[model samples]
Structures are given as C-alpha cells and as structure tokens.
Target: MLPINIIGYRRIQNRVKSLIKGPLIRKVLVLVSGTVLAQGIQILASPLLTRLYNPTEFGYLSVYISILGMVSVVASLRYDTAITLPKDDKLAANLLVLSLIIAAMMSFLMGAGWYAVGDKLVGYLHAEGLKGYLWLMPLSLFGLGLYQTLSFWALRRKDYKALARTRISQSVGQLAIQTGVGFLQYGQIGLLLGDVFSRMGGGGGLAVQLWKKDLQLLKTVTWKKLAQTAYEYRGFPLIASSSAFINSAGLQIVPLMMVLMYGPEVSGWLLLSQRVIGAPMDLVGQSVGQVYIGEGSPYILEKPRSLMELFYSMAKKLFAWGVIPTAVLAVSAPWLFHFVFGGDWREAGTYVQVLAVTYLLKLVIVPLANTLTMLEKLKWQWFWDIGRFILVVSGLELAYQLRFSALQAVVVYSACLSIGYVSLFVLSAAALKRHVSRSENELSKALMPDPE
Candidate 1:
C-alpha cells in the first residue's frame, strides 16, 4: 500500500513538472486565452456602459479613476516590477511583505484623509456627489494596488496558467457585477463595486496561494532582513513608479484644465476619446509588460549582448504593431466615431486622430522602457520621465492659454510625450551597450593566452 501511494505521488509530481517545462508557445496559449476573454468582456461592456450612462457620468468616473490611478501608483511603489525580476524567493517574500505594509499605511491614510476632507476636494473638482463616493474610492484603489503587486509572484514563478485564470475570473466578475448593478439602476456604484470586488478577490486568492506554498517561511524570516532587502531593491522602482504616476496624472490634468478653460462639453468629448483609445492600448501594453518583466531580466543579466539586440528587435516589432493601427485610426477615426456613436462623438474622432499619431512615436520607445526596468536602470527612466512631465505640463498650459484649440493642444502634448519616450530609449540602449562592450573587452583579455 505504501509503494502504491509513492507511485501515485511520483506520477502527480511528474505531471506538474511536465506542465512547467512546457514550451513558451504552450504557456502563452493559456495566457492569451485568458486575456482574450477578458478583453472581450471589456469590449462588450463598453457599449453597454455607453448606453446605460451618459458621457457626463463617464467623465465623472474618469476623473475619479485618474485620482485613483495616482494613489494606486503610490501604493504599488513599483514593487510589482521589482519582485518578479529578482531570483530569490526570500527576497520576493520580503518585498511582498513590505508592499503590503506600505499599502496598508497608504490605504489607511488615503481613506482617512478622504473621509476628513473629501467634500472640499470634490467641490474643487466642480463635480457634485463626488463626496458621497469618496469612501468607495480608496477601497477600490487600494485593492487594485494589492492585486497588481501580488500578480508579480505569479509571473516570477512563470505560472501564467494561474495568472491567466485569475485575470479572466476578475474581468468576468467585474463585468457580471457591474452589469447587474447597472440593470438595477445603481448608477456608478456598480462600476466601483465591480472594481473593488474583483481586486479583493484576485489579490486575496493570490495571497492565499503564496501563504499555502510556504507556510513556514514567515516564521523563519526576520522583519529587519525584510525591511533592509525591500529598501535596497525597491529604491529604483519607487522613483520610477512616482514618475509613472506623474505621467498618468499629466493625461488627467489636461482634461481638468480643459474643463476650466473650455466647458464640460469639450472636456467630455476629449475624455471620451481618451477612454476609447486608452482601453486597447492598456490591455495590450499591460499584457506584454508582464511577459517582458517575467522573462527579460534574467536574460539581460546573464547575456547582456544578446538581450540588447533582442530588445531592439522587440521594440521594432512593437513599433510596427502600433504604427499600422494608428495610421488607420488617424485617417478614419472621425468617420468611425460618427457611425458608431453618431454626431455626438464626431469631435472625439479628431481627438483620436491626434492621439493616434503621438501613439505611433510613443510605441517605438515604450518597449525600451520595460527593458530599462529589467536592466534595473529605473533612475535613468525617472530622470527622463521628470523632464518630460515638466515640459509637457508647462507646454500644455502655455498652449491652452494661447487659445490653442483641442487639436493644437493634442499635437503639442503628443510631441512632448514623444520626446520623453525617445530620450528614455536612447538612455536605456546606451547603458546596455556600454555594459555589453565592457564585459566583452574583459572576457577577451581573460581568454587570450599570455606570451612568456
């Protein structure tokens, strides 16, 4: 009976090992399936959401989400990117624990702060009823931060099957919950509830898995060591993450400024265009981001030269992907918007065209941004981001004050953002090249036989 049990256990272990050792294509199949289904839900939900809620409602949600984005960026602190890249499980655990601790502190602060001062803040935004929703805001953002950070462990383990399953489940859960609530005329509560529930479930599930996998690890690990490790490793990402937060805030800032300068109608149109355009970009970009971070860091550290060329090629491929679609969107966006959404959104198509052109230039350089993180050159990325943020914010204000129309503002913003992306790409590529060349020079000398 003992021998029989041993054989069964060995068979189960071998099956698991086989799945892990499967080809990249097989792994990506699982990943893609989940992503596709999730994107499908998003696609279906968009039209329903558009029908159920007016653009004004969406605009309100957009502003609310933008604020949430900034807060989430702070909560995450780029720990997601950091944890997945390092090889040490203990270090990963430390980072995870630290992320949770910081996230808890941030969540508490944000929740408390919002509760105390939300009316003033909401009034400042010129949006009514926002104060009523303030409690929901911090809960949603904190849950999202937790979900994103916990997702890093799945990538680190190359457990794409699990990752994909959780993502799909979350997306479906969100769609189902939101749709049901919308049917019940719950207003924006539906959207907020969907997000909060999805994140809580996904993050909580991942945390459970991590704990079950290594139950004794926490008992053996010291808090001091965890703190030191997290501090040392997360420094770069912390700064880089702040830059990213600023970049996203830059996008939202334009709409707020537009509302102040123009009117809610123009702001709504612009915000609508941004939502339609940003949805697909985020879906695709985020999916690739996980894959690159999961797989690229070890390759860069071990084979810097090959990884450099590989990264260059990957950038070009991504560029091509963005270029073709952007070109089509640039030419047909206005007409497409009219046909799909009627004349109400015709102006939005123009906004789409403007963003499309900028997105092309951005696509060329953004892939390199991921590589920069993999190479642990987060500071360089931060420098470039800060420079662009300053130029963009300043330029947009000037452009608007000069009475530039929506088109002009879009073009100026795009150009500045493109410059930032290009600058970061140049910096990342140069750093990688220098490292590779120096290593080669040393290796050549070591391998050469000395003459007596």
Candidate 2:
C-alpha cells in the first residue's frame, strides 16, 4: 500500500498531465513557456539595467520604443492579421506577399519623411535624444513588420513551437546586446540599439523555417494574385489599419505627453512601472490571445456556441489568474519596487498601484477582442478604437491643462483606459451573442419544411 501523501501527489501529477494534453491548454502552454522564459530574462535584467542607466536614459528609450510600436503595429497595414483567416494556402501566401510589399513601401516612406523633417518633429516633441537615433526607425519598422507577418503565418499553420522559439531568441538577443552595451557605458544609445535588435531578432529564423516548409506554396504567389488578395482584404488596410493605428497611438501617447508635461525622469519612472507590471500581463494575455484566435477562428460561423463558450472560458481564466497578483501588486508595489529596482524607482511602484486594476481588465478583455476580426466586424472595432483614442487623449490633455501632477495625470489616464476596456468587453460579448443568434436562426431556416 502507498502512503496517503504519495498517492495524492501521484493523482495530482496525473491530473496535470491530463490538462496539458488538451489541445487549447497545450497550445497556450507552449506559447506561455516561451513567454515566461522571455519575460523572465527581461525581468531579471531590469535590476542591472536600472543600475547601469539612469531614469533619463530610460525615458528617452521609452519614447523611441513608443514611436516604433505606433508605426510597427500598422506596418503591414494589418494584412498580416488576414493571414490566419483564409482557408486556402495559396490565397494566404499571396496575402503574405502583399503585406510584405506594403511594409517595405511604408518603411521607405517613413525613412524619407524622417530624413526630410526629423529634426523639427523631434524638437516639437521635446525628444531631442531621439534625433540621433531616428535613422534606425525604418529599419526597425521593417524588422517588426517581418516578424509580425511571419508570426501570424506561423499561427495560421498552428506552428506554436516555432513561435515559442522566436520569443526566446528575441529575449536572449535583446538581453545580451543591451547588457553588453550598457557595460560599455553607451547610455541611451545602448538601450536604443538593443531595442532595434529585439525588433529584428528571430525574424530570420522564422523566415527560414517558413521558406523551408512552405516554399512550394509561396512559389505559387504572383503579382496578379497579390493584387487580387490586396483588394480582397482591403478592409484590413482601410478600416483595421486605421483602428489599429489609433489604438496604438492611444497606448503610446502617454509617455510622450509625460515627457512634455513632467520631464524625462518622470516619464522614465512611468515607463519602468509599466514595463514591470505590463511585461507579465502582456506575455500571458498575448500568449492566450494567440492561442484563442487560432483556436476560435474556425468556430465563428460553424459552431457559434462553441465560440462563445471559448470566449467566456478564456475571460474567466484570465481574470482568475490575474486578480490576485494585481491585488498584491496594488498593495505592495511601492515597497517591492524600492527593494527590487532600487530607491529611485519607488515612485514607479505608486504608478503601478494606480494602473494595476486597469492592467487586469486589459489582460482579460484585449485577448477576446479578436472576435471582432474573426466575425468580420472591423467597423465596430474601428468605432471603439476611435472612442478609446478620444477618451485617452482628452483625459490626458485635460490633466495637463489643469496642471495636475504626474501621478494625478497617470490616475486620469488609467481610469479612462479602464473604462474603455470595460466597454470593449461588453461590445465583444454582444457581438458574440449576435453571432450565436444568427447562426442558430440560419440553422433553423435550413431545417424548416418547405411551405408548399
């Protein structure tokens, strides 16, 4: 006979194995494993980075990353998202080609524009530190675009393992370069280069993997097909791109505003707070999101109930996992930051406390927003994005005009964003309900007897 404790342990281990064997759980686990490792590297390196560089340097890097993010999210005009939607591999391949063409053209235009008026723009934003490094923007944008396009292709192929590998490589490459360059005392330039490297990292590996496996399919792509696919997916560029750009601008604009209203050090503090709090939330949320969309896309029309169930199930799991950590951080962030990131960062902890609930809501809602895309409801998403952009900008601008302190401004920003996310969740849920209702009605119509 076995001891009670030993038997219980065995039973628990078996249950764990069973859960891991489920397809959705297995896919999320694969991506989360990579995300965990990647975020872990960055989290561990934060202490050293803070020590090696000052708040002002981080503030400058934040601005650079913000610009990069705002551009890169729309770099492919969001046609990359369409990669996962098509049932036909050839059409998907053509979409991929179209996305690449657009990314290249956009990057060239960005570079040209920067060369023409980069100084004036930098001056306007009070981000003089970015003037020297603005040249790298186009390169970084192209790299990010390539990575995103390929990642979506991987998602479509259900190649979770390759995506996982890419995440790890990106983190490792970023850490090695940033740490080494920091040791050489390159200041903000080191941080900037590391960020640029991270954008391009894993792109080559993914491209090689894709070409090796899908070479024949990709070879079938042609100019005519590319043009046809572009027209077919014009909604992505026309509507989804605008929506995505606005959403990205809302998220990235805060730091720019902070730099203008407070100072680089204040912006740096806020950036670090966001990084520490956001890194884990994003890793888990994005990991689940990738798996959710890949798994849920097929059920949009075929099994609407299954799609709703999946959406509800994911939202519940995210909330359950997020609430406790958010609560703990809300209470202990100030001390934790002081202890972990050093004294200069204690203020960042306060910001974390203010934003913790907002982050939690975001983690739960943002993943499920993919439903809008899967249902071909880009217009709703566009409307929501526009509203969110307006709310965030107006809130921050009001705070600035009122001469509120940095923390007060952050509070206003966080509150406005939280409200926006809650509204988004409600909208997504209603969309799913309508989809389920429509699906059921169509089924009923099909099963009805003829009037004659």
Q: Which candidate is the best by TM-score?
A: 2
Total clashes in model 2, counting residue pairs 3 or more apart in sequence or in different chains: 0
lDDT of 2 by residue, 75-178 (tens): 99999999999989999999888888888999999999999998887777778878888888898888899889999999999999999999998988888888
Q: Can you list the residue pairs that collide in candidate 1?
A: none
Q: State the lDDT of candidate 1 residue by residue for 47-112, as single tens digits.
A: 676556555565566667767876777785777668776677877777777777777778889989
Residue ranges of candidate 1 with Cα displaced over 4 Å = 1-25, 76-95, 156-158, 207-275, 282-322, 369-377, 424-452
Clashing pairs in 2: none
Candidates' lDDT values, in order?
0.74, 0.88
RMSD of each: 7.9, 4.1
